[model samples]
Target: MAYVFLAVAIVSEVLATVSLKLSEGFSRLGPSVLVCVGYAVAFVMLSQALVRGLGVSLAYGTWSAAGVALVALIGAGFLGERLSGIQIGGIVLVIGGVLALELGAEHGP
Candidate 1:
C-alpha cells in the first residue's frame, strides 16, 4: 500500500544517509554505491507512495522529520557525534508530534 512505500522510502533514505559517512566524501566504492542506490530507491518509493494514496503533508512531513532523527542517531551512536540533552529532547518531541499526527490524521479530499 501507499504507507508501505512510505515506510520503504524512509528506511532507504536513512540507510543512504548513514552510508554517506562511510562513503568518506564519496571516495570509497562500496559505501558510495550504497549511498547512490539507497537514495534512488528512496525517491522511487516516495513517488510511488504519493501515487498510491497518501496525503502530501502527512507523507512529506513524516519522511523529512524521521530522516533527520535517524541520521542524527546514526551520527551520534555510531559515528560518535555528540548529542546534547536539548537536541535529544527536541528529537523526542518531533517523533511524538509525528506519531500524533499519524494517529489522528484527517481524511477528506
Candidate 2:
C-alpha cells in the first residue's frame, strides 16, 4: 500500500538523519555509508508512495512532521540531547498539525 511505502520512507529518512549525526562530519565510514544508503532508500520509497496516489501535500507534510518528532525523541533518549519544554510543545504541535492535515485530506474533495 501507499501508506506502507510512506511509512518506510519516513523511518528511512529518520534513520538517515540520525546516522548523519553519528557520521562525525563524514569521518566515520560505517555511519556515513548508512546515511547515504538510508536517504537513497527513503527517497525511492517516497517516490513510490507518490506514484501510488498519495497527495503530495499530505504525504510530504506527514512524512516531515513525523520524522521531526521521531528524531527528536531519539535524540533525547539515546543521543544525550536536551529538549526544552518549548521544543516538546513544538513537537506536539507538529504532530497535531499532521493529524489535522490527514483529517482534512480525508474529508476533502
Candidate 3:
C-alpha cells in the first residue's frame, strides 16, 4: 500500500515540522536531529508512495494540505499558538480541497 506509505509520510512530515519549531533555530541538538531525520523519513516514504503509482497531483496535494492542517492543530494544542477564526476556516478549506482532489481522481480518465 501506497496509502500506507503516504500516511507514514504525512505523519513523519508533521513530526518533522513540529520538531523544527522545537529545534529553536537548530540550536537545540536533540530536536534538531529529530527534525532532520523525520524529514528524511517523510521524503523517502513519499517517494515510495509516488513510485507505487500514486498520481503526483493527488499525492502532493493531499500530503501538503494534511501536513499544514495537522501542524496547525498541534501548534495550537501543544505550543500555545493562537489560531484565528479565519485560519480555522482556511484549514477547513484545505481539507475540503484535498477531499475534492481525491474524489476527482477517482473519476479521472
- Model 3: weakest 10-residue lDDT segment is 100-109
lDDT by residue for model 3 (1-109), tens: 9999999999999999999999999999999998999999999999999999998888898899999999999999999999999999999999899889889878986
Model 1: CA > 4 A from native: 96-109
TM-score of 3: 0.94
Global lDDT scores for all candidate models: 0.90, 0.95, 0.95
Clashing pairs in 3: none
In the range 1-109, model 2's lDDT, one tens digit per residue, is: 9999999999999999999999999999999999999999999999999999998988899899999999999999999999999999999998899888889878986
lDDT of 1: 0.90
TM-score of each: 0.85, 0.93, 0.94
Runs of candidate 3 with Cα error greater than 4 angstroms are none
Model 1 lowest lDDT segment of ten:
100-109
Of 1 and 2, the candidate ranking higher by TM-score: 2
User: Model 1, range 1-109, lDDT digits (tens) per residue?
Assistant: 9989999999999999999989999999999999999999999999999999887778887898899898998899889999999999999998888777777775423
In model 2, which residue pairs have backbone atoms overlapping below 3 Å? none
Better of 1 and 3 by lDDT: 3
Worst 10 residues of 2 by lDDT: 100-109
